[model samples]
Target: MFNYPPIVCHHDFSKSDLSVDTLPKNVSFVRPHLQTAWGEFSLVEATVQAIKLLYESENPPDWFILLSGTDYPIKTAKQILTDLSLSQYDAHIHHQEIIYKVYQENVKMSVMWQMLAYRRYCSWNLFSLPFFKDFTIRWGHPLLSKPSPPFSQKLRCFAGSQWFSANHRTAKYIIKFHSQKNSLTSHYRRRMFADESYFQTILANAPHLNLKNDDYRYVDWSTKGAHPKTLVMEDLPSLLASPCHFARKFDIDVDSNILDQLDTMTLP
Candidate 1:
């Protein structure tokens, strides 16, 4: 089993808020609140910072797993290690091209447009909008159209869920790729849901990385909602049987008992 160290990156955009005391020995809290606005660049920046921190640490991690606050482990530590040890892929990331033409025809007009051209420009989420009069922020200049050479030709644009697990080598490659490809990073920064495509595009384009195209995180997109449905008691059996190591969008407030059930199954 691995030691869990909570490296909290508190983003300060709207307000300054942070509180911590009596920390665990392994827990290393980043005290300063990074000046980050909501969107792709901010998310990318946070990830880069985490990677940098990891590299600088005395004990660098072998595997870099990105999980949101809402994410919960579906498999025990032993089980997760067993899967990783036996896996041959360099990285685990579920990805595909952004072309959603087939999906667009099946859905309603409103949903169709959103799914079809949602990544055309930035500001898909309200947090990036001009909600606050004085809150000035920027990700990148919006292009009149997709780049002339096509992003795919330049680096191969891929889209998928942001959560992923990559070995240290793959993680370093992503950061290195970002450093070298300034123009591509700048262009993606302005795109809606940049995090979803940025890393996927980078890793996918670099075929030598040997990405698995399976993020190993269970998410139910079948419910048809703005986000994945919150896992409830009814989802317990399926989740327990899943090969995925983690499951996302669980709300304990909705059903705290589900967490208890998961804890019994996941913990040693």
Candidate 2:
């Protein structure tokens, strides 16, 4: 959205809707927009599917970013491009090692994040009883003969926000990893909220790539909930000052003026 650049967009929309779209000539949507919902593997599947298509396209992009319909850029396109032009990393993603065990209270993250990080990314879709929490059910079965976790000491698990930015090489790796029914993809396909960990684990495990631990997205998580705080007009100053290229979860119904203001700041 900075200057005229090729844009590939995808959504869980209908065929007619795709035909009626009003967008720049450089923009095109990948075929077969699959249906997905919150906290489902389909979310990761849809995104990775689009990435695969883009990677294999005749005119593959040098870089690609994963974003939602609600996400809006705060920085100008020139600024974003300039930052990336000088970057040394192959990917920019928000990431942290997931221990997949009972969390210690002294962890730097908040209580909610600790719980999420400590919780297992389960491939098994069964009810779990939260015992003393000293031990988690490993998101799979814990017993030796039972279903063990897909990851191990070598394939340590990592997680972060679902959104990320990657260059062509990294995108190729993601496509390669997802193409086969390996342990990672196999277990993550049935895991709860796979989108949040699927790409992250893949990116982290790649020793050949350099990655920055920042996703370049601003999301206010100060409010108490699974969802981040809904951005409003009052958050404009903070948004402008943040180093992130984009901020998310804004609602026009709540405050359309924020989008109007951001449009002015980000528009070329």
Best by lDDT: 2
The segments of candidate 2 whose C-alpha lies over 4 angstroms from its true place after superposition are 14-21, 100-111, 122-147
Indicate the residue-level lDDT of 196 in model 1.
75
For the record, the alpha-carbon RMSD of candidate 1 to the native fold, in angstroms, is 5.2
lDDT of 2 by residue, 1-268 (tens): 6565666676668433555356777776767777777787888888877888777767787888888888999999889888887889999998887653343566544544644644546324444566755232444323322233676766767888989888999998988878877888887765678888888888898899899999999999888676899999999999999999989989989999999999997887
Worst 10 residues of 2 by lDDT: 139-148
Q: TM-scores, in order shown? A: 0.80, 0.85
Over 170-226, each residue of candidate 1 has an lDDT whose tens digit, in order, gives: 878877777785766877765656777778777888868888989999898777766
Q: At residue 134, what lDDT does model 1 achieve?
A: 38
- Lowest-scoring 10 consecutive residues by lDDT in candidate 1? 140-149
Candidate 2 lands at a TM-score of: 0.85
Per-candidate local distance difference test: 0.70, 0.78
Model 1, position 53: C-alpha lDDT score: 64
